[model samples]
Target chain A: MGTGFLDAFAQEYKQLLDSELRLLVERLDAPSIIKESMIYSLEAGGKRIRPLLLFATLDAFGIDPKNGLPAAAAIEMIHTYSLIHDDLPSMDNDDLRRGKPTNHKVFGDAVAILAGDALLTYSFEVISTLPNEFASADTKLKLVIEMARAAGTEGMVGGQVADMEGEGKKLSLEELDYIHIHKTGKLLKFCVVAGAIMAEASQSQLDHLSAFAHHLGLAFQIQDDILDLTGNQQVIGKPVGSDTANDKSTYPQLLSLEGARAALSNQINQAKEFLKKTGLNTNLLREITDLVASRDH
Target chain B: MGTGFLDAFAQEYKQLLDSELRLLVERLDAPSIIKESMIYSLEAGGKRIRPLLLFATLDAFGIDPKNGLPAAAAIEMIHTYSLIHDDLPSMDNDDLRRGKPTNHKVFGDAVAILAGDALLTYSFEVISTLPNEFASADTKLKLVIEMARAAGTEGMVGGQVADMEGEGKKLSLEELDYIHIHKTGKLLKFCVVAGAIMAEASQSQLDHLSAFAHHLGLAFQIQDDILDLTGNQQVIGKPVGSDTANDKSTYPQLLSLEGARAALSNQINQAKEFLKKTGLNTNLLREITDLVASRDH
Candidate 1:
């Protein structure tokens, strides 16, 4: 439960995730602009938290986590795509992401849009093409189907629509939860489930991991809401108050800053509880929960 | 085969495909706007050519064509998503499609974009979840991989970029070929290959189907270019000369109208010849080729 250990575990996955992503792009043999735009957003460097989640969960099962490398990279691609599309002028329209130019800002909206589209397609391709020896075709197909569902209309994209339509409206906590769960929760949950499935964990273990991820995802969003309201723009990599500026609702607005903080803590503790119930050596997962709970940026 | 026979064959698949698409959207249990936008595009009625190609190819092999319904619908969704994105303001900026307002014009840019994303993701979900009786997990995985390749940057999106960048430039036939092959050809080719794979065709059969599809796709594009120049706007569901209006290079623009016409005929013939090589009962596929070569609209 030390920063030293958490940093080391996370650092390993980040390097693997980053190198794999770059190689994935390099091997595409696509036109220069499309590849450049994709690589730019991917290599821009986020926290690599999603991959860390997948790797950590796989690690807890004592599986050779590298076997899940493609799937982890695929999840990151999906995350990167959501970010690119979310930053489009028609959507969040931010000029900066990760302290660099957003995809559309540098590549133009058309290329940026296509770049996101390409990555989305590539994600499925990556997972589907993983070696069938360790990862059976059935397992890969399940991963692809689950990832698609999470990323599809009733999940991420649907949540996006709900979020957009809710702009300028005061949303009830229930409505906000719907958006938060679908928007970010589904994919985070997928990261945890992906690890379990790849490790061929039992259904009981999967249920536990899924519950752990659900709370982790909610905590992640609540913390995001808190940071948007109170954190430093330099550290957070974007201006605070964007939600308020966009006339959208957030946990801090609906639940109050103190209420949001309490909710975050509750969710983090719940996540840890679920992890503990799995009866697996999840020390790394526990540290991640702690990192998510108390991180400043 | 008689036109009556072709129409009946096509009519059966269209109804099945249309109903399945509607049911799929209905079952998504998504928010209203996303559902509304997706159904609007899915039901807009664009000949369902991709699905028809899939069904026709599946039929030729004596495989139960209905078994491929999910995949056929998936292909159509990918095609629809491309059209939705292609017509975006930053892209072709078309206001009309199939004699109706474009998705963006109907639902606003954000919903249209997300609608497209939803459909793209849903396509894979549908294919991956196909009944185990119809397709082995290995077959499903291959379908997912090929679809991704066809839809990703190196295929459709890459073709679109090459197209957008090629605008207003004087392009040779070789350059035009590259764009058409990737943009329209890749997906079309996938339809053929998908059916073959589902039927577990031999390698020689696959090669023949691939070749057939390549010619059919090129012929399809040439005919589209011709229609852009000479067809009625109302019949074609958009203004004639939109391609030229956008300053895009086309077969007719680079090869003279007569030369383009001849090329179209040649390709259609080649497609038919390849089908003959497959030694499958491909009467329906041949008819589809003729439809491609001679369709005025």
Candidate 2:
């Protein structure tokens, strides 16, 4: 896999998104500390994979990816809120994320929780207030529906609950798959489906892209597990092997390390097959798939 | 202050909202505990004033209050989620709400937090997926925007941060009003505006109704503070004077008790004046406003 167009596309959009997200929060007549905490975690450097996927999906359809800016920012807010809440002392209790103090670590736990809640609530507001020129009310409503479901109980939150319950127990592959599919996969799929919606793609095209995202989601999580075992602490931004330390189940724990690698490869291949079926300019998506499968962090 | 019409209307709509809220949580295919936690708080027996206000607003427009059910449920969910988070150990740390153990007490902090997150997310989904037969996409989109703004940073969450920061400090009347208006007043106002939007009222009507709601929200919060200081613990469902115990400023604290009562009366009058200006069938709203001003809890 070559790091060709994805880097240039990502660089342009990531900068646009970073500023757009900042302005969105900064302009709110809210309390300063909460705004600071929200911007702090949001600016915390992750790969911005979810927003990139959304922009890339639009790019795949030969559309200007900037049209999806509000949706991308909304989705990133949801993702960022989940991370903030997940790192709370009551939850993952992590002190560092992306090599910086977690939201709760810098702000008190109370403010951190409120910051997450504010971000989650703001995501919907961002979409609902999208300008008429960007999308119709119908389109905005659809985006909100998709976003809410992907982040709510039937998706990421549900996955988090199941993962929490499955801790300290030997989990079956099927159970692990259920967790990953709902937790990580649903939102990734939403990113693609949202792009297709914005592009007014046919139902068949949306269906194929959704399938591509599903496989890509699992492959992404599997690589996450693999990276936990083998990636560097400095690169990954948190201590490696914390999943093992917590005695939680992972792809590498259920499947052997080599087996997890093979599964990741299989998922990547399946994701590519669905991308091919979409019959759009999927080169960007195809490259993203390879990156998810092989990312160092 | 006749209770005749308000009692009958309240009983019928309150039951409808309670069951509808339950069904909304029950139907999710997510984990049982999270669902149970969500439902537990939904059933925790508060007045359901937000939903009632919404239903009453529609009734004022001579529209069937039933048409407002989904939006009613959505607002109540936002209200309920805020309560759950407010009772978290990091925040208020209260064990009791409405005479029952708070959500975190029964479900644990982790599940309680997720339950709040899930409810908040689902509220947007509920509005976005409103059946086309009931409302047009334009209406739903507007409803989402109003609901999100009322519940998000500029409204409830912003108010919460201010309230949290003002704890154990001397707060001026202006500062206290700011907290009440944002923290409680915003969602309350959303209920009324949502009803007008759903009924497709004219901009003039919406503006009047919004002003009415603003005053009503302040009256409601002032009465809440009065109750906390003077009402019975059994009747109010929590200990009286928790506000004083926490060193939080209240209407009665900033103004003398007699002065607070006078202020409450002033707001109620202002709220009614706006309602009368709208020239709708505001009998129901007038009655509910009276009820809010005098409620023990």
User: Best TM-score goes to which candidate?
Assistant: 2
Estimate, for each residue in B132-231, the C-alpha lDDT of model 2 and write its tens digit: 8768999999888888889888999999999999998999999999999999999999999988998899999999999999999999989989999999
Give the per-residue lDDT of model 1 (tens digit) for A46-163: 7888888888888899987788789998999999999999999988888988778899999999999999999999999999988876588889988998899889987888888888
The lDDT of model 1 is: 0.91
How many Å off is the CA of A294 in candidate 1? 0.3
Instruction: Please give the DockQ score of every candidate, comma-separated.
Output: 0.88, 0.91
lDDT of 1 by residue, B1-297 (tens): 356778998888899999999998899878988888999999998788788888888899898789889999899999999999999999988898877899999999989999999999999999998899989989999999999999998899999999888888989899899999999999999999999999999999999999999999999999999999999887887789988887888899888999999999899889988999999999888888888888878
Provide i-RMS per model in Å: 0.7, 0.6
* DockQ measured for candidate 1: 0.88
Which docking class does model 1 fall in? high
For model 2 the local lDDT of residue A127 reads 83
Worst 10 residues of 1 chain A by lDDT: A1-10
What ranges in model 2 sit over 4 Å off? none
TM-score of each: 0.98, 0.98
Task: Please state the error at residue A214 of candidate 1 in Å.
Answer: 0.3
